[model samples]
Target: MTDSPVLRLDGVAFTYAGGAGVSGLDVSIAPGEAVALIGPNGAGKSTLLKGVLGLVPQTAGHMSFADADAAAAQRPVHAPDGMVGFLPQSAELDADFPINLEQVVMQGRYRSLGLFRWPGRADRAAVRDAIETVGLGALVKRRFGELSGGQRQRGLLARALASEPRLLLLDEPFNGLDQANRDALIDTIRRLKQRGVSVLVSTHDLELARLVCDTVVLVNGTQLASGPVDEVLTLGNVQECFEGVEVEIDEHTLVVPGHEGH
Candidate 1:
């Protein structure tokens, strides 16, 4: 735990034009660690991710990256290319887009390659490795639109991996997956952590968090609790985070009333 953090946010807040957003944020990710962000649909989880990516404006406190050169800055807006990789909700992508699996993954290298360069040997190799890392090596040539939802999700994950990021961010990645797909994704996340990649994921799946994450951050417009998974996910903390919402918990599952279909 003494090693330098890959990313850190200390009392940071990201605000929209109206001055409303998540606040009092404080968290850090070390190499090979995984943290889960659990919350309801509009709890600012997505906003947090966007803020880290510099897609939104930061309105308070500090943000730091591992690079010593930028560590002292108030907010290291936008991590350098390849330092962070993001996999947004699947719905954001156009399923009917004409890209193939390999091509979709190749898109991840674009930021590093910049506007003038084409995919060179190293770029292609990275893309291939990423696709294989997500266990979709056999479907490289398949059309993205033709794959099953799980395969499509894996392809998107591969795209994110192509950048070889030290920190990976996934926003509600397992939302609609069947059991088999969910298992596959959990396996993929474990593999990434074993390879020393840090993961920050926002999800409603308590099972996935228990199985794959080392820590959990519960948010309801703001951070409600954050610590080791077992400690932070206690019944009282969860109930308070989802206040006014129906929540049921048993030995192996935690269910929120409106989240049955998810």
Candidate 2:
């Protein structure tokens, strides 16, 4: 509930050199709000994330984070104190990479610890605290690849949490998770919001979006409809952006085509 904005995209536009797709993406996210970006395949959900991160160059408009313009030296975007933590859809880790879970979480702390500074007792304690927050205390010594899909996701989230970011960005986090894992992660996100972390999750799961999102960002890359969940996730809006989609909401209960077949 802070008056200042943590992330802001003003009249942003990104177009591929070959004219492949995506343009005119304008959005804003405030502090302590949980927002979900929903759309179909090739809808530029990933592209938008890339744009905010400044991974892809924008042809027009501007992006500023924490009131700081995305700096040129950083390429895509830069926030001081590692103002943001991002978890990609596909986390690259070697099965026999030989990195333990504790070490993995410590990676986030590297930003605060200068390149020459080694991770000391303080860093180790912070990593332990982050691991416990994700409910992975028992598996601290386990190899990252050794955990199940859900646990692995949690571990990845723990890594993100280690950075102590005010704004968190995620791309397709629910890709390989099951019911139990999805529920657990969703709850974890809610907790983060409660603690005043701004969250932006890109997902294809309508039910999950409707459940965890306070704001829904309906994106089609070149197009975007963003607002409160009920206003943006309406039947007409969903069909218009998602195509061939049906949504029925009765008494705050949304009947989506995939989850309940409502």
Candidate 3:
């Protein structure tokens, strides 16, 4: 993979019309690098992801993808078509929906195919590959509601992968996963990195960040600190981001006071 950054944001600010959001942010994700976004509730973590996806408007700053210059003017609302994939916190799929796993993954191709067009041979192949990439090939025909929580998450991940995006954005991807599923998800993320896909994930789990990310960005409505994981995830930075909350640091382990029993 090239050494160029897949995502670049300079002094970016996004806000819902008259609503709270993030601002004055500068961040970059290089090809194959994974960056973890950490913060307390209402810290704009989800807003940042929404801004990148064009679900929210960017009120200020410059954002660009790869060689695409002046993207703020050319493509201000969102990442370029097919350049980014997003996995939201909630899939919002009805467990009773009749759609199968492969059908769900094929939805990722909708942007490229348009509403009138159908999946072609290449699109089908992409769906197959994406499912296999997440180790869900055997469950391709399973109903969406039948899979466990972790399995559903993997299925969503496969849907994201089917887009063949250079950058992937995940918001609280590990929230409901059990240990086995979490381990599998981590392995999947590792494979994505090896394949040169840059990743930006927002999560509360510091251990998860330490395990899968190369960098960490601590945010509280705005970027507090961002750098190599070891530097950015220090006791001081984390506690500062989580203001008023009790945090304990022991070697490489960090425990938030009330969350320790969880």
In order of appearance, the predictions have TM-scores of: 0.90, 0.86, 0.91
Q: What tens digits encode model 1's per-residue C-alpha lDDT throughout 170-214?
A: 999987888787888899899999999999999877777889999
Which scores greater on lDDT, model 1 or model 2?
1
Candidate 1: count of backbone clashes, pairs at least 3 residues apart or interchain: 0
Misplaced by over 4 Å in model 2 are 69-77, 245-262
Full-model lDDT for every candidate: 0.85, 0.78, 0.86
Evaluated at residue 4, the lDDT of candidate 1 is 89
Number of the candidate with higher TM-score, 2 or 3: 3
- Looking at model 1, the pairs that clash are none
Writing each residue's lDDT as its tens digit, candidate 2 over 132-205 gives 87788999999988988888888888888898888888999988888787778888888888888899898877
Q: After the best TM-score superposition of candidate 3, give how far the Cα of residue 201 lies from its true spot, in angstroms.
A: 0.2
Residue 161 of model 2, lDDT score: 88
Best by lDDT: 3
Ranked candidates, highest TM-score first: 3, 1, 2
lDDT of 3 by residue, 49-108 (tens): 999888889888888778776734445645688999999999788979999999999999
